[model samples]
Target: MSCSGMETVDELELVVERLMDAPVAAVWKAYTDHLNDWFCPPPWRAEVQVMELRAGGRALVTMYGPDGEVVPNDGVYLEVIPERKIVFTDAFQAGWKPAGPFMVGIFEFEPQGDKTLYRGRARHWTKDALEQHKTMGFEAGWGKVAEQWEAVAKRLA
Candidate 1:
């Protein structure tokens, strides 16, 4: 349940990968510094309340839906590899205190010439959770967010 550098569990994970038209550095900067600008898809917006960006640091954000719905996510970073990878989960808080876990999120950005290969994954603790994520439109939602992230990276490039 620590999920630090854990391998993907096919039955409990959903992923979104993209070949972005931007450099790794730019992509990383956008992700680390401008998360609120691209973390959510259109009709929704995200505000990063805290993003310490180091192992055990806090990763908190509030997402707002167009219809006035607010979703606040609070988590801690499990690992951070600069421009390479980021792993976080709500399983633990900033002091490693156990919480009600939903999933572990892993995001990787690989350098590919002037472009970057980005992969985002959500690993759930149970099959029911995974099913719930699927029912919530995980693929389409994450895919749209990826596209938005890529655009932000491109602008940063």
Candidate 2:
């Protein structure tokens, strides 16, 4: 809880970050793989439909709701720098085919000595979607996922 070291994102990018007591490589693997189904806490299965870890790759994630409902989160890989950065988006599907894009996800990993600094940013296209995501309890939801990510990362560490 030593947030005195916390860094703020500029107004342009709208990024949110958190520190995890795990190594960079381990944390990267957990996110790259389908750890969500096991690590993400209750009312959420954290299922991964597909994940291809390379440029032009695709990842299909379904966030399961409390009552067995599914929300599709599809993204294509834009940049991949091992143990450092991953940039992807549901802005378009495979083949750059447009499908009324909604959001962009950027994950940047910085080495914090033995620990890792994880930056999770989701930039929605509009204020309404951002608001809807907040209404959906993004802080709680993503925060849990980060907690889950930490567990997985620690195991790998």
Candidate 3:
């Protein structure tokens, strides 16, 4: 989708969007389910462990790259608004173990008539960090995950 001067801004200011093939509720569930089979990017698999759905709740999401190479990406829940929005940060793991500096993430669902305006935003610490993520194929990686999510959402919608 093209920019419409209506984009929301945040820390590192990274945003991605998709028109989900499924309904808003299904898409929202995919966003909340850390163990979702569709959360990982293409060519990689994921193992998720979601503890709760509230502020300070923990979620452990381990992404496995090619050949079962695992990279753990867990975080703490900052806020969750049912089927509308979710806020989390990469500050801790499932067991409340201290980890990396916080990277705030916001996922919002905007219903457009019969479609869902699915969006994801993540704020990194520095410009260099954001640039580093871009260089790592952020768009392509996340796009793939969105596609997977759409498929799952449609099936379960």
- lDDT of every predicted structure (CA atoms): 0.87, 0.73, 0.72
lDDT (tens digit, per residue) of candidate 1 on 1-157: 0112222359899887888889999999998889999999888999999999999999999999999999989999989999999999999877888999999999998899999888889999999998888888887888888888888999999
**Candidates 1 and 3: which is better by TM-score?**
1
Best by TM-score: 1
- The regions of model 1 sitting more than 4 angstroms off are 1-9
Full ranking by lDDT: 1, 2, 3
lDDT of 3 at 62: 80
Tens digits of lDDT, candidate 3, 1-157? 3222213265476777887767788777666663357877767888775557788888667877898688877788888888788888886665677777536788788876655777878778887777777778767776777778777777667
lDDT per residue (tens digit) for residues 1-157 in model 2: 1122222243223455678888888888787764674445686676788888788998777778788788887779888899998888888787887767666778789999878888777777777777676667666666677777877888888
Name the lDDT value of residue 145 in candidate 2. 71
How far off is residue 77 in model 1, in Å? 0.2
Clashing pairs in 2: none
